[model samples]
Target chain A: MNDSVIHIEGLHKSYETSAGLFPVLKEVSLHITRGEFVAVMGPSGSGKSTFMNILGCLDHPSAGSYRLDGHDVATLDKDALALLRNRTIGFVFQGFNLLPRMSLQDNVALPLIYCGVERAERHQRARELLVKVGLEKYFDSMPNKISGGQQQRVAIARALINRPSLILADEPTGNLDSHTSTEIMALFESLNREGITIVLVTHELDVAQHAQRQVHFLDGRIVNDHATLHTEASL
Target chain B: MKLAMLGEAWRAMGANRMRTFLTMLGMVIGVGAVVLMMSVGQGAQYSIKQTISAMGSNLFVLLSGSSSTGGVRSGSGGSYTLNVADAEAIAELPGVQAIAPIHPGSAQIVYGPNNWNTSIIGTTPGYLDARSWPVASGNTFTDSDVRSATRVALIGKTAAQNLFGDADPVGQTIRIRQSPFVILGLLSTKGQGMDGRDQDDTIIIPLTTAQRQVFGSQFPGSVRMVMVQTTTQEIMPSVEKSMTELLRQRHRIREGLDDDFSLRNLTAVADSAAEATRVMSLLLGAIASVSLLVGGIGIMNIMLVSVTERTREIGIRMAIGARQRDILLQFLLEAIIISVIGCFIGLLLGIGGALLVELLTGTKVIIALSSVIVAFGVAATVGIFFGYYPARKAAQLDPIEALRYQ
Candidate 1:
């Protein structure tokens, strides 16, 4: 590949708790190409969430190098990093973190507003994305007024509204029912088919089975990383 | 801020209308009080100056000093040395407009069943011009009236009302000291003077009649005082100086001896009153500014609370790629908007309050435009001064930490 969308080498993160420095990630290296769907899995202390946070540019690595879209994460300032994230990466959290007071369409248009898009175009693009996610009927409904599954769909639409090449979802289906989880996984699969890269962190193996590649972590280090033909076959 | 950013602030305020209105109320009270104080002060000064000018713009009085005789000290004005001849001498001086001699005494007037006891001022026809007093009805006494020692009188409004009821006092006969005198005119109303003395509670009669009939051989040709009116206000100082010199020379008082007369300028008295009003205005304004400071503290408290309440919102905005400045601007704009609205409300309240003060106190209230601009500017400054810390706190929030904040 000419340039990988996300490349990590020797990534490390630690927390300064009262007990002492507690290491979360230890020298974890991963490369995710454009148009690829990868799944990250581990036990509770595996630091999968920490690794996801590092990839999303929301947290700084203690001792490592991370390059997102050819820009060194450590070298960029907070504002420049925010701009890079806005242009290149979209994040979907397990909480379906749509602002409660905003309407579904307004929630989807949040990213465009940060990028200084004009009002008319921001609304238009948000409406188009809402339609793509089958949320056109709830365009004006507050996020609190919607179902958990519907809120997650709105999050996904928000994440894709910026036309980002990469999506980072941490336990995206963690709060949804199995039926809704499957529906969301199907949406992810369809998006992956459209030449969009996806990296999701999940604890369930069945949910991980939707990805073309699976990486497992234990004790803050990646123990197994492999491609599975059957995962793609099932899709 | 750009339109969208301002809209966001405006919408945020709109979301909690009651809280926003309450916050603005503090500023309104502060600014409104400041304007009201200043306006009332100015109004009082204006009314006082007007009263002074109406009484007499360029006026002064010369009173006869006391005389000592036979190694015995006499009371002030006990031995009259200044007389009517001295008044005529001063009146002929350059820049002098008119001079009226006064012979003041107490008297009781009786007309029909009504009786009123009042002060009697015996003066010439020039007294009205010298004192800026006009005849409200009938006519004033002429030079011939004074020459003949006529028993004609001009009654004051208060004296007339007390003695004549609803009947016209002019051309009517009233008895003073059991002597019936025909009324020449009713003196124009003078309300109350700055000294709290009722100007309209006394009557005016010719000096000759007062000296011959009222005093009746008490002090012939020796008037109590002379009121001098200058042709122009600018010539008052010169007139005062020239009159003093002429009186001293005419009285033949030695250079070492104290003169037998003193000059008092009404304008000087007015200036002192105006000075007191100026000091009062500043004092009131200072007291009012304290409330503005209290209002600023109110803004700081509310802004700090708002920042805490909106932490999650700040986190979400940060995650959506907003810069720190963008977050700061949004919150700061919200503060400015609140204060600006408060300033407008304060202006209305200030004018309304001034009108109310005027109605209650019967003093005119003038709202200075500069006060509005200054109050508005100070209010905006208060907003920025108090709003900065909260806005900075919001902007400095760490995205992950804020996102995890409940």
Candidate 2:
């Protein structure tokens, strides 16, 4: 779509292994528009993680181009790309990746620290986001002191701290129980309803069902890109 | 980045409290050792100067230059170019307060069954005035003692103690070289000199008595050295100049030739000795700096381990939009903070160590603020130098690789 916030064209990635050259992604092009909730699903060894890495600006594509928020990701320098990522994108890992030494509020306020936000204002926003995620009581608690579900919720609060338009959650509920997973999926649905674009990676079809659009990856290429029949009301 | 970044470093350092404390201990001991070494050395130098200048700071000795026999030159002080006549001339010069023509002789002093080997200095009454010494309990020698060439003598406190025990040596007869000499008085105690020699282990007698009685054959007007006392310390140079001119005129030495006599200032000797001590202090300071270097290496070692241990954390920060420079600064700042804290603790420990040294050794150790400032400046520089590798290692990590680290 012309309103695409993330536009990928002829994207490719490779690794120079000791065994020689190894190609991971081949001619994988995808577009993610604003305010869209999308799921990227694939089996293990299918280069799904590699694709996610490139999309997060944590890795560079060997060839071809990828654009995020209308900025050319391939041409931007490391610092400029970092600035773009800081302003426009947030990440959620399967491990919940909350800094264990920090309090929940501080973990949530971490992204804002890079943004040069004042201390009081960062804490204020972190508190507000925590309350929104039903983690108001755990604001001062450390991540390891809380449950897996609470940690993931805190991570989501962290992702939203900088008010980024796009969120990339890689298996957000991968380590959570089935019940906690559904609760997290429900939270993602609510965030999606609030018009924030989210692109998540999951192996479970049940988790992928929560997104409005599902893109299936096989052998490093997209095999299926279609809208999901399930709605937020169903979840 | 933000001031918030500094909080992260503080918290990170705080999280490893035991390790932090151990690391800081190295710096503390290093700096303490350096400061203590320098201060104690300085104190020793100060005391040495004081002791060297104790007798008479402006005292000047006119020593005869070396004499040549055929070709081999005898070292200075072995020659007898300086005589009583030169001393008499130097005494008449302006700014000359007192002059003592001293001739040194060694004798076995025997008081009843007690016998002791001591130096016998034959000088006039002006010697006591030049030395600023007063008789502690008895009278000094008179000018007639030198004129009549009497065998009467003045004993030093140490000699009196050794020969007469506790009994008063004054008015008692002490036999020297088998000749009975009455002890006129006991000289005051002057303690040990700069060269660690007992200043009071001697006796004073008339130059005429030493030449006629002790020497048995030496010339009547011969002197080993002449001690010239100036009226004021500031006029010492003028007195020395006049004395040199008078001696040269008396010796009939030609121009463009070395004088047959040389003058040595005790103040100059004291200053050179003090300079040697100052050099020793600087050497000790340099040696102590090795400990600071070792301490810095400890910091680098721990910082590297920290970087490796927190690889995943670094990845998370990068993934969340922390730039490479940010990561670099975070780790670098952490190292700097550790060193800064180490330096602060070290300063206190060093000052305390100096005071403890002074208390234990009875030496006054002075702590210069400039030394503290230099030590802390070195610490900061060391932190930056040693911390760079590990901080760079953290900053150079690929986010993808770091996140994948276990």
B1-406: candidate 2 lDDT, tens digit per residue: 4578889998999899999888777777777777778778878887876676566667898877788999989877667888778888888898989989888878899999999999999889998888788888778889898889999999998999999889888999989999999988888888778788898999999988987888653445777788888998899888878788888889999999999877888777877888998999999999999998998899899999999999999998998999998998998898888888888888888888889989998887888877888888988988899888999999999888999999
lDDT string, candidate 2, A24-134, tens digits:
998999988998999999998889999989898888999988988888898899998787778788899999888878899999999888879999999999999999999
- For residue A94, give model 2's deviation from the true position in Å: 0.3
Return the interface RMSD of model 1: 1.8
Interface RMSD of each: 1.8, 1.1
Best by DockQ: 2
Of candidate 2 chain B, the 10-residue stretch with the lowest lDDT total is: B215-224
Query: After TM-score superposition, what is the CA distance of residue B281 in candidate 2 from its true location, in Å?
Result: 2.7
In order, what lDDT does every prediction score?
A: 0.88, 0.88
Global Cα RMSD, each model: 4.3, 5.9
